[model samples]
Target: MAPRANPTLRQRRLGAELRRMREQVGFGGSELGRLVGMSPAQVTQMEAGKIGISVERLRTIAATCMCVNEPLVAALSDIITEREKPGWWEEYRGTLSEDFVDVAEFEGQARRLTTYSMAFIPGLLQTGSYSSAVFAQTFPPLPRHEIDLRTAFRMQRQRVVRSGTTPYAAFIHEAALRMQFSGPTVLAEQLGALIEDSEQSSVSIRVVPFDVSAMPSSSGTFTYAEGPIPELDAAQVDTSLGCRIFDAPAHVARFRSLLARFESRALSEEESRDFIGSVMKEMESKRA
Candidate 1:
């Protein structure tokens, strides 16, 4: 079979799991290949996510490696199926960065999402004008066309919340709520949209007020996407160069903890709405 030049994160994840199992059993590529009836190069290719593996072969490898985790094996099977499916993000491939499409892939399959933003509302929760305004402020100002493309891409991400199936929990700060991305009118509309979305049974919006006595020193934005299984979860964080995604157990766990800390510092659901309401009123009063 031909090798894949660019494999999705899910495909890579499946290979990673198999590689981990092989390592646990103290088997090298040559040995594993011999046992699995494939060439050593084939094993290497599969491990590197350049080649696909069927569920039956995957199960055989798991058994040979003494991996008894039924749930993990089941999850691997699911990944095999998801790897073949095309996603909506494909339409915007060249229009956006590869990382952007990857982010959509994660969000599309996430069973639950937890995000923490200190300076801006997350893309998934942002309204059209708010997103366009945020893009406009980017340094080395983007071309008008790029700004429109980014805005549209961001708006597409809102389907996660609009679907009303995946549970979404966002922890935003007071500063973000006050930041007039597109002046008072647009900011007010953005915050109002947030308030309305918060009413969804599956969506939760929490605010971390500036007056809080003690809070974590860390200031960054991250999204933790939980898959059907815990081991498949991933975390995406913004970086100077671009967005970075982490699925390794250690990285994912740290992000999960970081988000939890942010959540703890945020106001309760009911209180968060009241806080947002006050901010909305403040904005309106300023306009008067």
Candidate 2:
């Protein structure tokens, strides 16, 4: 088969794992190629995710590299098989940035999602108006048609929540809760929806109050998308530059640790609901 123009993160991840495994075992491209019955060029193509690898070949490489982790092997196999399936986000290919589509595709496949946001409501929980307000504030501002497309795209991403099967935990700071994205009414609706959504068995929303003594030293927003197995777990963080996906063992572990810290410091789920309710009431009073 021909090479993919743009491989999904999961596809790249599989290739990356193969390369890492081989290197860790001191196997070179030609050496590994001989063992896998592929030429060095073919092995390079597979490792670059420019081409696909058969499940049997992948297992051979894993075993040759001395990787005995059954779960990891199974996870890789699953990813290889799943790669052939097209994702819903693929429909937006020509319209949105590849990074945005990648994020959506990642969310769809994630078994569980944990996110922390300080400046704005996390996208999964954001209301239509709130998200529009956010896009409206973007620098070099987009055209109206573009803004509408982005808003719709974001709302589409919330389908995972509607499914009510994927586990989601959002750690939003009080500052984000207090910010009136479009206006008091919009923010109020957003917070109210948050409270209601928190009641879902699959969703957990926690608030980090301003009174908290310590906060995550690192700032900005991030989402940790857990995979079927630890090896496939990844963290997506947005920066001024653009979105970055972290999947290295060390990077994933650090993000996981940071999320744990936020979870411990944030309010209990019940308390958080009450806190949001109180904020909604305050918004009402201000508007009155």
Candidate 3:
């Protein structure tokens, strides 16, 4: 098959795992290509996610590399088989940046989701109006139509959280609850939605209050998606330039540790609901 102009994060992850397996077995690209009946260039392209690999070829490579991890092999096979499947996020491919679609895809495939937001609410739990207000603050002010498009897309992505199949835990700092990016009315409504979501059996919300003696230092907001296996886990951080996805073992490990710290300092789910309720009441009073 011809090379892909742009490969999704899933594809890249599959490629990385393949490369890791090859390196673990001490096989060079040319050596693995010879064993797998492909040229070194073909192996390189596949490893770079510029080209697709058939499940047959993937299994052959696994066998040749002496990889005994059946679960990892099976997970990789699943990703390859689903490579052609079009997700709901595809509709916004041209209208929105690829990062947006990638994030949605990541969330959809994740077995579990966890996020830490120091300044703003996690996107999965944000209401439409709150999302619009957040998007409006973009440096180069977005056109009204574009802002609306993004807000709509965000609302659609919330379906994963609402599905209640995959477990989701959100650790939000106290500062976010008090930030009035939009008017009090919108914030109040958003807080109300958050409390309602917290009631879901699969949803967990925790708050990190300012009274905590020490805060966990983080570069910025990040969402961590737990894959079918630890090797496939991914962490996504939004930046001024764009969304940055980290799947390297070290990076994912660091993010996991950061989330642990957030949990340690955060209020329990029950306390968080009460805290959010208090904040919502405050917003209601301000609106009055």
Off by over 4 Å in 3: 83-85
Give the runs in model 2 whose Cα sits over 4 Å from its true position. 83-85
* Each model's lDDT: 0.87, 0.89, 0.91
Model 3 TM-score, 2 decimals: 0.94
Tens-digit lDDT track for model 3 on 1-288? 789888877788888999999999999999999999999999998998889988899999999999999999999999888746688998888779999999898898899999888788899999999999999998889999999999999999999999998899999888999888889999999999999999999999999888987776776689999999898899999888888889888999999999888878789999999999999999999999
Please report the candidate that would top lDDT against the real structure.
3
Query: Can you write out model 1's per-residue Cα lDDT over 104-181, one digit (the tens) per residue?
Result: 988887899988888898889999999999999999999999999989998888898888989999999898899997
Could you tell me which residue pairs clash in candidate 2?
none
Please give the RMSD to the true structure for each candidate, in Å.
1.8, 1.5, 1.6
Model 1 error, position 1 (Å): 2.1
TM-score for candidate 2, residues paired by index: 0.95
TM of each candidate vs. truth: 0.93, 0.95, 0.94
lDDT by residue (tens digit), candidate 2, 22-65: 99899999999998789999888888888998899889899999
Q: Locate the minimum summed-lDDT window of 10 residues in model 2.
A: 79-88
Sort the candidates on lDDT, descending order.
3, 2, 1
